[model samples]
Target: MAISDIKRYTHLTDTDVEALSAELAGIRRAVTTSLGAADAAYIRRTIAFQRLLDVAARLTIYSTRSLAGQLLGATALGVAKSVENMEIGHNISHGQWDWMNDPEIHSRNWEWDMAGPSSQWRYSHNYRHHVFSNVVGMDEDLGYGVLRVTRDQPWRPEHLLQPVRNLLLAATFEWGIALHDLHAEQDRTGTTAEKSALSRALIRKLARQVSKDYLLFPALSGRRWRRTLTANLTANLLRNLWAYVVIFCGHFPDGAEKFTRAELENETPAEWYLRQMLGAANFRAGPVMAFLSGNLCYQIEHHLFPDLPSNRYARISTQIQALCEKYNLPYTTGSLARQYLLTLRTIHKLALPDRFLRATSNDAPETASEQKVRAIHETRGTDGRTPRRRHRTRKAKRQVPHGV
Candidate 1:
């Protein structure tokens, strides 16, 4: 379980690992001590803003049939729901603000504006996904039971249309996520028993979500029920698409690594951290966009310290990058636009079984950086903008020399 046992850390000595552990401990202590009035106020203010947006959106939709009203209402609702699902709910459920000990804001008590139940999500997402990460067989997030994300995952005929499947999944991401918790694939493959009770729990959770959005609220509008229903659907669709994009970009960009079960055997905490670093990607974004995405743009930091207050992710990103550099680790990051495109391209490429067919391809294939550059050249060079040679020179300048 020692860090040295991991192939990626072969260059590091035990003393080098001790240095990393100490550095990480220092970061945690500093951030933990800094958590107090500012952190609490930030979350409280965010909640209030989200509530204001939700109420305004709903009232506007109920009172007016105008196109402007509907647009405003839908946009506002989508933003509010995005904040709830990402910034508020996801972070809280990671126990980020649990240190405050406020009953309402506590992770255990906070239910999000998604189809999945908070408790179930905490188990599947906070515990399982965080622990297993991109371990091919173990990480449910690898394909979310729909498309082929890694070459190690056997491609099926269904995956031949993954580009279409990926789009549909994004549009209905909330429901997709809710169903993901069911582990239907496990049951189908006979790898595990069907947990009928968990399935029932998921169904009940879906029912509650449907009731709130499609049934209860629309009914409250009486004559305006149609408008309200349409608005709710629009809001949910927007939120789902946004979450899908952000989550996918963070975990499946070209540079993000995947692992086999053998690679994960006897993983120590340091090795676990290393796996997270390899498997996660970050994107460059500003405060507004970051907050909407739950600051998951700083995904490398979030994975390294899941329970850290998300607002602090941006603040500590520089330090984290420095630590990664010191340890000679890849701190994968890019513009949001670039990273998202990379993810989409990856989805399309893996749809074919070509990678699986080339047997030695797994051992000695294109490095992530090469794949990323090739993707960009193929996808973006049509505009006749930056010349290939100039782009290569720029990329070379950006890359840190190995063993630095």
Candidate 2:
């Protein structure tokens, strides 16, 4: 079939497009109304209590380990608390608890209590990951010196030892990897230096407090120092390992795209969105796993509509898939276990010689006529009442998915 014919057949009609737009608007309205009706003070209090519970849980695991009797029980409790941090704590901190409340306040609170001062999962995962998406240079999830998960950029010498580095990072400093991108941002943006002197002083004080907890609290618990150290170490290790594995399983699968800025800049919004969907894999959908991962399994939906609450990801994904199909775009997804295996397979592929990593024709752009249709679809309506398009501009003939 001719490219123009394919384009006409695939692109959504204005009515279909309007329907998708209305669905998204309805979701926003529902979330806004729910937030407006919620008791903000109650949410704030509950979030505070949850933070305290998390701290208590962590301390309990440490103390239980020092006492050395219920190893399995302690581990289970620690895992449960970690899951809470991922779900409830993370959600509230994201201001997903009440949409009406100021996100900045909740973000600050989240950074303080739930995520720890060092954790940047909010900015890296929530902000940057969704905004920039599968684009390599922009997506902080790609690689952070420790894990060579995606092959978006040219291979570096350090990447040669990615397997070893990733394992060591998971074992020793998983939290550190989470914060690396945030630290890089602070350094690049000079925000770290712009902090008030008093704030800096307070941060030093907090660092000291955390250090004391790490160094002295375990020994002071009246248990054997060795036992206390071992327990604390094990708890930290397990927590980091779980975090690393879960995140890695989400996007580093085989067949996932690792697009460069050059490649992305040449594509239209529909094409970029399509690439993101195909490049990002979903985990298996289950209540427990969804709850634990904060509903990240619907990653494609999450990427396309980040403002929407996580609870509605699965429901919205169907709509997103329909839109993709209408545009003749790929909508990639898979079970959690399948995606995890794919990640291992991707790693193996990366292990191949650099010469074998060359791009194939499958990665290239579509015909000129296909490009023209994408351009027409992406053009803003001149009705002069709609929001002006603010996303990336297109340059090549490629399939891009529309926002729904």
Candidate 3:
């Protein structure tokens, strides 16, 4: 799995990898040093706007008497909830604004509106998922230990229902994440009492979340409780579905490569940086879409510097793209719709066992290893040399990849 004896599975050599790593580190340093009042003001204003929107939306839902007015209020509330969940809560929990030294904005103190506790999610997400990135067996976030995202992960008989499970996962993404994190917590080395404590924490968080949305708000509506209850349910589901789309587009797209445990052996910062660059994909977005997705359309940049302010990702992406071009690497990105379609393709394709797939585990779009480059070279000639490309006519057939 060695690429020019560097073991990074990339086109770059050891020296080139080191240089790439240094440039990335420099970008981080530049962004870190420039964190100023603008960054602080951005986060503060975001939080205030989200809270105000939430309150206004809730009031509209309660007071609106007409059906059209009810739908409008619920939709607005969903937008507000999505903004809070994606931009404010998600970034704050990443410790992105920790540099400001504001306790309210601190990662550890900011609990999200989801059913899962922020403390529990931090362990599974910031530590396990971010640190491991796309390393097959280690990064549980790779398909969240359920769907088969890569050929490297062998398919099972149960994966036949993956298409169905995919829908369910999207519709209930928040609940899935909550249970996923809880399961991750229990799987660790903990005594029975300790396990019970973790479960209780999740139960308490879930109770509070459920009550606030379903009970308290509806009860306040008196005879109109059913209408309020349905509105809250609709809003929560909308947020869940949107979060699912943003998340899946980032990790499971065709060009976002998956790695094996072998690659993590004696890993260096340079190699780690390379892994993240190759492992995460991005979707094209304007300012509005970026805000709606919590600026996660720059997921490659976020993965590169998880602790950096999320608002800075747009600028960081430009520098990252330049480095990718200089290093002759893939800056994997596309329109949001295209990226999601690619993700869905991978999901449905990998539902079958590997034998049914056309590509090897090492050379597929969603999976690759260092040997991948060598395999391409050897295919062209026995001397490990590549041949010239032959142009095809307009009438020539196109070769479709597996599960196209």
Candidate 4:
């Protein structure tokens, strides 16, 4: 089912589609050419600032006993950790700065400050999630298989508790991501050897993180071991929660669209761009918030150009929004607070079955008599048209189990 078959955005013609694709390509080419010294300096400076903040926070927490010191240190450390995770780690892993040819900042060489291994994250996130966007079955980021986010997903009794599950998931988002990378939810169905391998890999990655944050840092604090431990825990939790919120706001907001597999069949490149636009939401924020959220505040642009430098999103966003308006497409966006609230609402709404809600198909209606006439005409290949009925094989005609 192509975009044309759906008739959801009937205003766009083939010429308009081509024009849109060409315009986007022009933006990409222009941006690529513009990437130079300034972009490299921005990434380097950010990394340096993040590291300095982390060190200062740790030093303060380890040396002082005052409540003010503890609060300041913990908050600073949390900000540093969140910045590293979102701005430095996430963008570097996306190869956004790789055009600079800096080995240190390259996706292949960078390791994120998270529980999930960089290699595993690239495969699951940069490749799978970016490629599929909000496609229901293909994009694992859609609820991460722990919650039902959209009405298109089949509802089960287990989903009834997702609202409660969401809090815990957000609090421990880094660990959840690690397990998600391993497909831990499907461990029961995996072969023993495969499960064992995945478990070992996850444990090894987790051990490295735990050793640094919990053991090594705390032990090095001398008399303030307990304080340091608490600070590290607090920092990790804050980063996790912030990342979870920002990500949820970008992905599952009220207007973010989700697509069924049927809608993706034989999708064209221009239609693929349309899917990314429809499936991502943006939030209004200042420069500081943009930096903290890794410029995922412009998530619609990010989804469309995942490997483009984060700084470029803001500059390009106005043009992208204008293009959407010209195409008469929905450009889902709002203030951060509104978007976050909408995400929470979506999660809570889909957590339980909505008996009154029903799934709608994109296919157009045809009367039985009209259908019979069309079928007969199609069988005869009349009016120079291919017969829809004769093209499908008997095996292809049989329905498979839903979602399989």
Clashing pairs in 4: none
Q: Per-residue lDDT tens digits of candidate 4, residues 1-404? A: 11223223323567777788889989989999888889889999999999999999999888887988998899899999999999999999999988888888899999888998877777788877888777777889989998887766778999989998999999999999988877733333457776677678778889999999999999998878999999999999999999998999888876566666765788788878777876788888899999999899999899999999998999999889777656555567778888888778768777767574442222211001122333345456544432322222111111111100
TM-score for candidate 2: 0.68
State TM-scores per candidate: 0.85, 0.68, 0.92, 0.85
- State the weakest 10-residue window (summed lDDT) of model 1: 392-401
List the pairs of residues colliding in candidate 1: none
Per-residue lDDT for 358 in model 2?
61
Give the C-alpha lDDT of model 1: 0.77
Alpha-carbon local distance difference test for all models: 0.77, 0.53, 0.81, 0.76
For residues 1-404, could you state the per-residue lDDT of candidate 3 as single tens digits?
A: 11222333454578888899999989999999999999999999999998898889888988889999889888888888899898988899999999898998999799999989988888889888999888878889988877989776767999998999999999999999999998878878469998899999999999999999999999999998998899999999899999999999989887677777777888899998988887788888999899999999999999999889888899888888777656656677888888899899889998988888887776676665556655654564444321211211110111111111
C-alpha RMSD values across all candidates: 7.0, 9.0, 4.4, 9.5
Question: Could you tally the backbone clashes for each prediction?
Answer: 0, 5, 0, 0
Q: Which prediction has more favorable lDDT, 2 or 4?
A: 4
- Per-residue error at 62 for model 4, in Å? 1.2
Error of 3 at 241 (Å): 0.5
Q: Write the per-residue lDDT of candidate 2 for residues 97-184, one digit (tens) a residue.
A: 5455566435455453222342445655566666566565677666564555544345666666776666676674444543464454
Q: Lowest-scoring 10 consecutive residues by lDDT in candidate 3? A: 395-404
Candidate 1 deviant stretches above 4 angstroms: 1-10, 184-194, 355-404
